[model samples]
Target: EPVEVVVERALAAQAVGIDGVIASGQEAGPIRAATGAGFSIVCPGIRPGGPVGDDQKRTVGVAQAFADGADAIVVGRPIRLASDPQAAARAIQAEIAQALAAR
Candidate 1:
């Protein structure tokens, strides 16, 4: 969906008392602004500098997601399909740590 549509839906969801919304990283900032700091924005379609393939279209790196005001990020294919799942998870963790530290 377009980022504007996602933001609109998020705002509507918040208005109706929903605690959280799932949206692309691009919409997190606007949604957060409209809904305030307490509203949870969980971003999916995260792709950490790799092949995007076909499933997801609006993907962002971990750091960018956080910068965009995502309260949490959901990653799937990168960790699940990696040859070494543990290492992939660790790498993502490191990135998240670095991003948090930078903030």
Candidate 2:
């Protein structure tokens, strides 16, 4: 979706008393600004330097998602399809920690 439309919808959702939104990381920043700091934004389609294929088009790294004002992120394929799920999860956790520390 176009970012302007996504932000518009997020603003509208907030206006009607919606508490949170699921947006792409790229759109989270504008949504945050429109909805204020306390509003929750859960971003999906997170990719950490892996092949994205064609399933998820609007994806970002964990660090970028947090940097773009994502309150939470939903990660799928990377951990799900990893040869070592535990290690994949740990790597993502480490990325999250580094991002938070940078903030």
Candidate 3:
């Protein structure tokens, strides 16, 4: 769904005492715009620039997610499917550190 629709639903949920949601990195911008700091958005399907399977959509990188306004990010495939899972995890953590520092 578009970020606008996501935000609308989030707002509706917030009206009923909800404050957190899982969203795409692409929706981060509109989420921040509409809900500001109060709503928590956890971005999933984060891809770190590699060949991807067709199962995931609306994916974004760690840096882009943070830059656009995702409060948190979930990284899975990049690490799970990597030749060196440990290294991939380290790299992703470093990327997360850098993005957080930039913030």
How would you encode candidate 3's per-residue C-alpha lDDT over 1-103 as one tens digit per residue? 4767888987887779887889888888887788778888899989875225657868888888988888899988788989999999999989889988998
Residue 81, model 3, lDDT? 88
Off by over 4 Å in 3: 49-54
Best by lDDT: 2
- Writing each residue's lDDT as its tens digit, candidate 1 over 1-103 gives 5767877888888889999998888787888888888899998988776336766777888888887788899988899999999999999988888777876
Sort the candidates on lDDT, descending order. 2, 3, 1
Clashes of each: 0, 0, 0
Question: Model 2, 1-103: lDDT tens per residue?
Answer: 5988998988888889989999888888888878888789999889875336757778888988888788899988898999999999999999989888887
| Candidate 2 TM-score to native | 0.91
* Ten contiguous residues minimizing lDDT sum, candidate 2: 48-57
